[model samples]
Target chain A: MSEMKWGWPVIGAALFLLSAFIPLIADGYWMSIAVTIAMYTALATSWALFSGPTHYISLASGAFFGIGGYLVATAMSDYDLSFWLMLVVAPLVSALVAALIGFATLRLSGVYFVIFTLGLAEMIRNLVSWVQNNFLGSRGLYVLTDFTEAHIYWMLLVVCLVIFVFGWWLSRSRLGFALKIIGNDEEVAKHVGINTALAKVLVFTTTGFFGALVGVIIAPRYSYIEPNQVFSPELSFMVVIMALLGGAHRLWGPLVGVIPFALVWETITIAFPNSTTFFLGLAFLFIVYFIPHGFAGLIEKHWLRLRS
Target chain B: MDILVSGFLLAGTYALIAMGLNLQYGVARIMNLANGEMIVLGALAAFWAFTSYQISPLLTLFLAAPLSFIGNWLIYKFLLRPLVKRAKNQGQLEVDSILATFGISFALVGIMVSIHGEYFTYSFLANPIEVLGSTVAENRLVAFFIALAIGLVLYLWLNHTRAGTSVRAVAVNADSARLVGINVDKVSALTFALGGAIATVGGVLISTFITLDASIGVIFTMKALIIVIMGGVGDIRGAIIAALILGIVETGVATLVDPGLTLVAAYFIFLLVLLFRPQGLFGRRST
Candidate 1:
């Protein structure tokens, strides 16, 4: 890779590594907040990797994330497996599921695809809830671990850094160009001999892998894992909103969206806890109407104007 | 036999739910994700009125229709009109409308929760009525008839009226309809408002039978979506039949198999239909 492509990830890695010292300097409260920020950054960035390019607007992130959490919780509670092994297994399984879903539903048009994904998440949640209620004789599983907030934060930061690097490489890759063409016009991409379905499914599967990995990394924080807790549709919507707000078109767009959103979300959670969804709805409306392309678009606009 | 009868009765309400969504998506070209919220809100209105003032749900329908009509008109006029204006193409409009409506659904749910967070059920016409030998709840019977009445009116309106024909024209080809001097924008907003009214009326009817809460709207939304797709996007007769099929399957699974698996069964059927006949059961594949 050229120096231009290599520069961002290196700088990003250094920043992530530098952020690992927060536990030593900050209180537990701040560390928790930092963990939340890192977690969202990882999720939004991974979400953007596929959705930004393809413009698919998937709401299945929560499904994959929940699958990851369930894998960890079920393994830890039922068997004597190592957390590390489950992490590897969780993302693989999630990716496989996502590939199946992608092949099945990606033929649908824009609105149908969006609704199908949201429906898929809801369907999985219902299935999981029913299975647990009937077969397991319990509502949820316990995942007891000794990992601190700071430890989780560091893990998430590392994940985010890795994702940024991967995304940076992907933007310069042939597949990335294919996705750009696909986003601009799938018919044009097909006429040019690009395999649109394969390209979409591959990226979607990668997103699933990352989504589940994030879930596994953060599972210990919850201690008890219920289907509803992990598979909340609100989480899916929030991730989409943040990624879009930051500009899913850019590799670093979700990071820009995640930071401000995480902070604001924290405030919303504290101020009017019951009305979080209300505020979330409002946030979506504003973003779509006023800043559809997100902060990345706005920044690029100003920068371009200045240069011109 | 009783399961079939019950399912048929259940289909009455489901058809109403799906029909409203069909109009919005088909005519207005706005897949209102908040469609279910409108249903829940109607239910809430009925529940509140019946419990507070001993008003009949039938009476509440008269109240909900105009209110929801006006409310939805305003939403279309202000919030969604700009989106319509700015969207470069149908695809862009779909994305914007979906996100916007999704947000609206959440906001409505939030508002509902803040006002009344508890599960609401009230005793209204709880007596048993004999339908073809097996007894069914009178409330269910009442809801079924009301749904039938509304469905008939809607079908007639679409088939016979000039205004409704214009709505259908826009659904078929907006640009062509515009070339013929039909105001596509006004027709769209009117159709959207009418759809909301129909959905709210459906809600008032269904509320008589089903227990409701603020968060249960998403389930209704999912079911309506399934029915609308299975029936085809813009087909009324197809929607009715599809709703009946869904109602039968759900009731059959709930009775014979585990009750909790009804939702799972519905989703399974949806997947099968999507895989095999994406254009819908009766709809010819569009070119």
Candidate 2:
């Protein structure tokens, strides 16, 4: 029993630490895959942080991510700001935007909330396109940052670490309990003296912050950033699906869901090119039918039954 | 004045899609995000049938609509029914259904794209017709009348027909309707069929007005959803009115402002409506 308590976590920590050094041994090709895994892990975890706990099903990650990319792009192009400065500014701006919208949106639940989030992302996409056409005078911004894949890999590693640590602590905190209660029943949460609305808005803002932070970090790693590319609903769908596939109810579920799927995605795109989205879509259908509870859910379902 | 006239004329075409979405979501509670793809089936079928066998797009409806109707019905009967049965409650059902439909969108959209090739597009030929001093594409006029005819028929059927009334009863309260001996399964399937048919017609009509490819499904679905939300979920009249307003807003922006700003205006209206009046313009005030 004691070994099960300490040994598993110890093994997990050792594995994560060992992965941190892979960038050293891994060539550029493998490093790219590592970076993708880390990015999706961070995104899926951030998605689970709000949607898993509150059951909101947000499609706003693409919006926040696009905003972050554009924000960094504009800051670097127009003002000659450093990537580091943009990093700090990105999450704050995204947080502010989220807080502004979350005020009204927090009132909605179920499918309406889902539509609102998706609509918000589309709205932002359109707004960015309009800005690009009028102000930027170009469809996309090119940033000539001299950062290597290794640098971005480390940045992604740190981002994933921060997100997971926060989620771990949140799962144990008073607010975590409050969030769970809210997800199960909002009316009960309110009756139990929780500030349901405030909790939702605050956590939702944090989710937006981290989602946008992915954009800020990834923008310089690429050659150019485009509004349509960054603000794609496909990105939002991937993050949400990844989180659910991993089992959104737990902190580690996203990591579990993202790693294998990210590798599979990379391989398929490399092998088949345009057929990846089709494969991904097929994958989604399979998940909903056979394993609606996700990887974690599958384990939990059997584990409890076995013990009983 | 020309832009206004054209915008409203375009609105006439969009009314069917919005109404279909309203029926699916408002009455059936199925949040079919593939509403866009539902129409695409018709568009692709019509296009394929027309190019392959010397038939007009209008006449292709005989081939396109029934196929889409059956496809959607199977989706409800086989895929959705079991999931709804196994779910804990409505909230869980909504979430699960969205994910499932999203999966369907991807799977089906992928298939459509692969078959037609993603970049393939075709246009219906039509001359310009002057309407209220504005010259519009002759196909657009044809599309407007087709859409209007469907909307009128739907409104009358929903208000007067037995199947429509049964659907309304099921929409109002499934348990009560079931207790009253309404065939819940039949009504649900019928609603899905109607929803599918109207959206297919919407797709068939819209394809004539612009160049269309497989990927246009999401755009149409998104438009119908926003309009459905705007119109108040269950109200047919509201869907019609909202569709017109959205059409006017979209085309008006495209004509009067920068073409790039058209989508921006529609989304802005969508967000404003979501924030202020989620019950929508014509929906009964939600408690």
Candidate 3:
């Protein structure tokens, strides 16, 4: 089902490694930007993994990401756990939540599913809001990080690589095939003997795992962590936009979408911070209406036309 | 007693908003992610009219509703119609429409924010009137009555009017309606217009009670969406009941606990409903 040739994976591996060298060349500012790019790349990749295949536009990434953040923040704040321990536990925690939510939400179709996923995130955020208000006394959680920006960049890089490789592998996996078939036609997929619900849940769980894992690692960078900041709907919209803007169907599509968006995000932050969200919405409209296939597909189409 | 009356009034206002969404989603089968934008646009109209011409928001409802109606008619005719036509299947259409309307929502919100800045509040009558031994804002009572009047009018239009029959027919089966010489496209456009008009009135009502801003639309978006689903996708009566439950719950939570949890109550109900009753409280059970 992956249908990827050997050459593409080889190229992807080389390009990924080249990205790791950014910290060596760039200063701290650029290093920070690069790290953000890597984080979004990982997010977009995981998002594409689930949503691209199933066509189930998920709005719960922010919730999962926040869950990861709060989980690690609580651990550090209360239990004083090591960052390394969270490297394993955070994703697992997120996966559990995803599994629970996916069980109920996976049955929803179309717009109901989208709204529910969004509401799911909001519900979690509110739950966290309650916990923070009642138990934590409305004070923000803080974590100690001895690592420099470069270390953070490398951590993000490693996570991004793991996601990309897994995505590459999944493209060829049985589950991936099942998801694609379900995406094309759920009834047909069932008729063909695939468990559509199971495949959908797996996609949701896997994506949730990465989304939270990244949040666990990234939370230490921010000194103060609050539920509202981590669990905003805008964050969910960001990853979904990146995945959709790239050709979600392809492994590298998210990367294509992420690189440009991350760069634009950097520039826009410096130039006009408030307008970027608006612009992101405008960009979504243009891409969905004009170029639904995304940049990767646009390139493929052009190449195909030329060859023909 | 006061809480009950206040909650019922709040419920009435919510029904006005949710009913429009029902018309659009149930009858026209358009999710209209920009549904909140229509409401916001109505608020903006009222605010603008009030500021420039010294018109009362209650009086400016006429201005806001028609403008929103025309604005949504244009959106449906020009933007949504073409893209919807191009979609291959229901799934494809759903995602595309969500994205497109989302885009419109952003563009409109952005324009409003840049022009007016994010924060806004339109003040109305401050004097509290006693209603059945409970002191309530006059604006709230008026808003409740207006919402109730419109809801009744909409129900009558759907049940009695020829256009209402056509809308119901289109909702039941678009192809069948089209085959029977009902103009499905026109009904859809009219539904969007009607939805826009009613949502605008809801916005006008809320602005009377609360400080209106560009971001408030996001809150209404979540609330209306939850009410629509909790009531059953396209059932108007269900939408009203669900709206009342949510409005009461939200106000009760705000009164008893934290005001912030008002939205939290909405999310809680939405999740509980989805988990136990996916078809919604009032919707027919579907496999």
Candidate 4:
């Protein structure tokens, strides 16, 4: 193991501890912001697993997240399933759905892939809204549980840590290398006997799993899951922004990207409540243009230069 | 019969929208993700001009189209050109174009939401004309004619004109076109400008019939993309035919099924087309 690689886990552990203790030191409003940042980090990291490695942009992360939230709500409310079971089942179902989508659409590349996923997401969102309105008789599902904010926070922290470690491992593993090779050149990877299609499908499905997992965690925290709020295009846009801002392929990039993004979002929404979308949109554009590597990329480059 | 006629008209509108995107994507090979935002800009500009100045809808197109063309040209020259240069340097024009265009799209949406509040705005210059014992809005009829005229003009220009041949040559292969003494960059810029102009006209037409909101362009963009895909990329004739078919299908479904499900259905069809014929109905397979 390289000494430089050790820094990631060290930083991650420190961040986990800092995030857990932040609520204790901060007030309710600040805690709420922290929670939001943590949520985005989880979601963005989940997205990075697919987009960063395989370079297959799945614009349906928000859809999977929404599906997970809805599944948990339904399981708890209608089926009386335990919270733990909901967590496991929700992501599993999302992964299965993502696999189906991947099987159909992942063959296309670049803009075509983006367009197909965007269409699929819209279709799923419409379907969900239709079901919620017609059958559920509610625009959103609400959770009625004895769970406290602290319990939810702790649950999020554990999940985030597990996801981070998994992401770290994936980035270092042979599968990770195969994904990178495919991203760089599929023909060459295939020439060398890598099953490019299977690798892409696996990454796509796994990313959906984590996205849904984050959704399950966040739904209980908010205690509500609405089709519009959960399956928003804006949410998908924000996750892509987060991953891009942090450096798409970097582990811990999402964490680094999410903290600043969430903070800016919170601050902007507080100050310009009505016009926050405009600012966020502008910020996304600015980051994409000027800071292509995002905040994490900037830090990594500068830090490496300084160290060297 | 009404569904058929209306569908054809609606498809004409979609063709206008997809024409610009087709030029940008098919001919220029630029993966412009921000195509939808440009349509929004056009629609908003026309709407604002009509609301604020009470300009005639016809006159508004004259004003809006030029402005959108100039604005998009400037964006390509200043913002997108640099990225294209970088892509050339890296030997990966397609990937870089996708990233740059994605950024531009996000920025455009932001600027739009900032300038035009999220509320839906209706076009003020409204007049209807009767045709075949059916009431067709004058603006819709005018928009349709303008779109048809533009499409015809583009086809004629591309097929019969010297500059059009040069643009097609460049689309076929930039390096070879350059070797043959064609000014590839100029052709690309012109094609991009043409696309911008077409989208602007589409924006004006669409706003006349539907409510104009900050987000409406995205839906239009999606529809245009679907049309382009269905029509087969790079085949202008196919795009035209496919646009009409899609418009009729969408309108018929909206008439028969839930209006909201219309887009879902259209998207479902797009997936089916992609699965069965990935190159699109008329698109050539990429070599």
Candidate 5:
């Protein structure tokens, strides 16, 4: 109804349009990198939807992502399931897993909660890797169906748009306010009669759902799934970096964070492959120390100052 | 009998690592994600010293401890101190610490890789000592005793000294400690130095058992986390007991189950304990 309220969606639409033309304008190598940035943006934004608001850090995003990939791989390879069914089933399975884990561990807070989720992720990764190695008789799973990269690009675009809309809606909803209260001060929230534990569980499950959705879409594009790539700590680290670098608690933080990081990583990896981590480390330190508010924060502050 | 001997020896080394984490997380209340990188640094430093100078591994521990302590002190002075001061303004120092430490860990891994290459480097003193009808490698056994001595010294220093009281007071409440005329920053620096020293000892012992590599620190860091969690935060005696329990359980599990399953099982145990006793085995419930 209000002009200001419609601005976010308009921006989202413009970005989507810009992304649709990226593959056409860019070379194959850049296109591939662009695709990665898009995937990480989706994952990071989905993760930030819960963590940025609630402060319940789930170190298990990689596990959910891996589960989604494995689900698609197994469905396609073992059962001859269609790509469409794999995408639906994978996210649903991941959501259910998240619900169970959340119910079990949502009561803990701070460092304990973090370590618990991390442990759960590690367990799931090991279980999946063991199954792939022992039961499947392979170190990784490959997609049987032939699919083009363009198909993946379009699919990810659609999925990312859906998630973005979902995030925007959630951030404005009553539930988001409840999460904000719990994040700021749980004891005060409990005193005010908010169901703090339930809210946390719900947010965790929702985050897992979106993360798994991204994983399902990307699995076919890669045409293969390995436990290392799917369930590595690097995935979790990347998401955190994206969220923090883009300005946690902002809607478009992930997009701002993931795109630049992906670009820099791609460029540096090509020039000096072994030194990428060193450079990334230096960049990370600089961002944490000097640019604590990240890019989005800078944007928000400058915009407010200009208005004032 | 052999299992018992090995378990005790391993427990001693683990105690050293857990003590380092305990000092940082417990005493300073600063969760250093780069704690493992400090261990890696100490190990690599000792490795370099041994290979280049042909020094005995025993002497390297003494040499490495101060180096690691100074390195970590610098991290606190340059990197962490400024962030801590800005905590009131930022309101996200915890998250910042995690990111900064993660960066440090990555940087350390890169440095190690560049210096030592990707291949595992084995450095051991070629000797064994027969004790209690079991043959213990000389380096490992000596490292174990040295770790025990360090642990004792730390325990006494923390319990029976005036400076230790100031450190404990600051850990409880920095503002109140300042009100009571305690120098909180100096105490924090001392705690960091002590933690670094302990980590260096752990590195020395760990290097004796396995070949040194860049990625080795992460696992050890995780294991130390498990030990500290199981032991109870801010409780040194509890850490010693917990380390022994973990050492026995891990050694037994490795011997019985697949060696690869050790971390999975330990983490599972951690999850289980957290579900029931979130404060840990010996930690007091917070107000």
Candidate 6:
């Protein structure tokens, strides 16, 4: 058990060490791709941490992620606050909002929760757009920063590592066990004396924090943060797809989904720019129909067959 | 007075769209995220027929409904059936169906964008007529009357027809429906197809006044979902009332406040309903 506990992290650490040097050797385009992969990896991973176990499938990642970007943009552009301060404040605010949303909708049936989350994201986007148009007198905010692409990449890598480590720790924690039980049978979990709502909210709050933090780190890449662009429902969908494709059930699953999807998406974007949405739609269909359990499930199945 | 008349006109069109969703989600138990795409496609077909061949939208409606009915029937048979069959539980089915339809919506949008690549609008009955001292567009009046006629027919059919009773039975309980010799799967598939056809019909009507693009499907989907939820899920009368309320609120907001805030107002009302009356305005709370 001890060996198993240490083995995964050691391999994870080695992989992290190897990935840390990509900026030094890769070309500009490749570095940008890596940044994209890293950003999605972080987003998908954090997203899976909640949706995976609870099976609630919150589509509000856009709201949280956009909040992060909007905060950093508003603070740096309007208030002239330091980026460092945003790093602290943005995620905290995201957690608060997520907790509110979680409490409000988590008790409902799964369908209502999904719909509410989707609506909430759209509502926030509309609200932001309205505010920008009416009061700000601009459609977007410029988030100019001295940080380079490599710096952003490195920060995302670190965030990825932190999330992975936290996820690893969480898997062995009491809350994790409670979450697993709730995911399996909420009524049973309630009878077993677990505060199911609290457990779900805590995990959701953490996911929101990570989602926002990624938005904060990635905001500089966009330079100009528009409400429509940053608060996009597409981002929320992509995060959900990537995570589900990788198998949200496992901690390391989203990474597995992120790498291939990000690469394929990059190719498709360049090759058939017009048909990207078409292909994206196809991707969702294929994943849901064929690989609903994700690659991780397939691997586990294969492993079990071999052993048997 | 103007608001009431215009609101009623708007509600007349929205009723078909919302009822389509009500049938699908309320009866078939599939929360089709692609519903808006179906609407857009219907609008596209109408636009194509009207502009390319100079056929009336009324004429195009006949072609669009049967075609969409067959298309959605096929979707249910091939794509959704597998998911429905394999889903271990209701929750699993909901998740799978939502994701699949979401994908379908994207695919539909992609196909539409490739084909049309622009907004579609046409002049259909653009003349104005007086209504209770205020002038309303002739097209909107026509749309209202047609919608009212269709809605009445649908209400009667659902309440009076044997097939409609089975559909309602499936909505009420699939297991009991099956026990009573009703083919649950067939009814579900038919209901889904009917929903799609109705949405297309609504699109044909809406396209008379509103301009449509490939990407505007999600907005309509959201609106339909709001109405379906606001009204009782399976109750057609509730959906009609909800649609009317939505139309009035939207028109009032558009006229009184900013036009851009109309969606905001609809969402706000939806949120209030969700928070305060999750069962819906006319629905009895489920045990």
The numbered model that scores best in DockQ is 1
Kindly report, for each predicted structure in the order presented, the TM-score of its chain A compared with the true chain A.
0.95, 0.93, 0.95, 0.92, 0.92, 0.97
- The better candidate by DockQ, 1 or 4, is 1
Model 6 over residues A18-68: C-alpha lDDT tens digits?
A: 999999999999999999999999999999999999888888898899999
| Alpha-carbon lDDT, every model | 0.88, 0.82, 0.84, 0.77, 0.77, 0.90
Which pairs clash inside model 6? none
Give me the iRMSD of candidate 1, please.
1.3
Q: Return the lDDT, model 6, position B68.
A: 96
What tens digits encode model 3's per-residue C-alpha lDDT throughout A53-162? 88888888898888888888888887899878987898998999888878877877757678877656667777778867887687668877887778888888898888
CAPRI tier for the interface of model 3: medium
DockQ of every candidate: 0.73, 0.62, 0.64, 0.48, 0.50, 0.72
Weakest ten-residue segment in model 4 chain A by summed lDDT: A276-285
lDDT of residue B280 for candidate 4: 79
Candidate 2 local lDDT, A1-308, one digit each (tens): 66587775677678779888988899988988888888888889988998997888988888888888888988888788888898999889999998877887677666666877765666787777777787768755776688888888788888888887788778888888899999999889989999987888888898889988988888877758777777877888889878888999888888889988888877888898877667877787778788877899988889999999
lDDT of 5 by residue, A1-308 (tens): 38778787887799799889877777777777777887888888888888887765567878888888878887877778887887888898999988877776777665666656655556677767666676677745777556566667777788788878887788878788888998888889899999988888888887788878888888877787777677766677677777778876787877888888888777788898887667767877988887777789889999999999
List candidate 5 segments past 4 Å from native.
Answer: A117-123, A134-136, B1-4, B89-91, B123-136
Q: What DockQ was computed for model 4? A: 0.48
Docking quality tier of model 6: medium
Is 2 or 6 the stronger prediction by lDDT? 6
Error of 3 at B154 (Å): 1.0
Candidate 4 overall Cα lDDT vs. reference? 0.77
lDDT of 4 by residue, B128-189 (tens): 66677666666667677888998899899999999888888987788899999998777787
User: After aligning candidate 1 to the native by TM-score, how far in Å is the CA of B133 from where it should be?
Assistant: 2.8
Calculate the i-RMS of every candidate, to one decimal place.
1.3, 1.7, 1.7, 2.5, 2.3, 1.3
DockQ versus reference, model 2: 0.62
